[model samples]
Target: MGSVFHGDITVGYEDEGSGEALVLVHGHPFDRSMWHPQTEHFSRAGWRVIAPDLRGYGDSTAVPGTTPLAAFARDLAGLLDHLGIERCVLGGLSMGGQIVMECYRLFPERIRGLVFADTFASAETADGKAARYAMAERLLREGMDGYAHEVLAKMISPATIAARPDVAAHVLRMMTATPPEGAAAALRGRAERPDYTGLLSRVTVPALVVVGAEDAYTPVGDALDIHERVPDSRLTVIEQAAHMPNLEQPDTFNAALGAFLDALP
Candidate 1:
């Protein structure tokens, strides 16, 4: 279902279905496999599903720089071009969201739709970004385990993590596996990223906004903010879920995401 290939360094991705092409991008500390539910459902619904493990994360090579998002965007665009896709729907979670924004900016004409799940356009600016960068640097240098544990606690709802140790462990392992430098650099880039609030207002494409009701990282409030800014953007909040609503409430998440893709023109 998936293969590892070179794109700004060797990267891996999974492809499925056979209709309108839709690309799924995973967040940091995880691989494309994270989109299992949504991708499966959308594929069955008749849309081509493409999920790629961005460079420097998952089983791929690491990108050493401050602007990894640019490379990530290029990878998505290149993948589509390589597949001979004239246009495609762009979807992402967290860092994946950042990548989509960059991709849209870089290749606006190729984007047919937008899906943002548990993510937001950058909010920090200037010196405020410095603090976030410093925090990431500290974590990279000496806080991998602790950072992983902290992320685990916040990423999944307390009930989910407490009920499923296996899932919790898998997520933590992914977070821990992220190259510290890569993670730090990626975070720093996101922290200092340009405000896309203005960009959202200009988005002529239909958009889908989804988030975990209990997501502490990018909560429902953040999702609402995006919904308000983007034109014709529909918002869906998945209950009993945290940052990873897709993993925690797969059925609901899949249903909502599939509906969005299906409704797309």
Candidate 2:
């Protein structure tokens, strides 16, 4: 475990190996542990893997109010600064993917490549915004216990839940353990995120857009849309996996990710 202070927030992260940097960000309601497979694989393959628990998740400090995507992006940049990494191949899954895009928007010079997995670039629709706010309220009113149980299948596929009990348990554990206040705050802040569709077009670095064939959240169409918009990008759809392919099907996800990293300039 590694720690870096950003104001009152203490960012907790996993830093391993010793080579070119590969910084990964986990999704909402999940800690840095979600990237365990990637961290282990990439680090062994001669890359310094850095996976951080975003504000309010894992071992990091949780801010009570809304935490914007830009705040997450800034925290990532600050972490890199603390590590003395001038640039890196930034990758993220789900909400983390959006944060990675935000990083590119804020500091393109600091990014060498991008990996956007199971995420979209569209802004929140009015109905979606309302739903997020409602969910936030519900999270605060109740807690993560009920919500975690309800969303397990959606987070990963029903097939995965049944077939891979270990993966399912890990996913459920992460969601259940998340601080409701932090999750709710992220929900509120994510509600106001701007559209990144246009922003994808201006991406100067190599980009890899990946999705699970069974993904319920961000479908294959979303990945396709991102791939089309990004000037230098490739797309891969992993079969028999859902939103969390990195865990559901680690070998396939790692293979695709490894190939991308190998080809990066």
Residue-by-residue lDDT tens digits, candidate 1, 1-265:
5544644477678888998888989897687778887788888888898988777677667666575567677777767767788899999998898788888888889999998999988567678688778867786679577778877878889988888777787788778777776677677777767777888888989999999999988988989999999988999999988988888888888888778877877
Q: Residue 234 of candidate 1: its Cα lDDT?
A: 97
Badly placed stretches (over 4 Å) of model 1 are 1-8, 126-128
TM-scores of all predicted structures: 0.91, 0.99
- True-vs-predicted CA distance for residue 192, candidate 2, Å: 0.2
Q: What is the C-alpha lDDT of each candidate?
A: 0.81, 0.94
**Residue range 139-207, candidate 2, lDDT tens digits:** 999999999999899889999988999999999999999999899999998999989999999998999
Give candidate 2's error at residue 255 in angstroms.
Answer: 0.4
**Cα RMSD (angstroms) for every candidate in the order listed:** 2.0, 0.6
Stretches off by above 4 angstroms in model 2 are: none
| Residue 101 Cα positional deviation in candidate 2, in Å, after optimal superposition | 0.7
Residue 83 in candidate 1 has what lDDT?
Answer: 78
Q: Find the 10 residues in a row with the least total lDDT in model 1.
A: 1-10
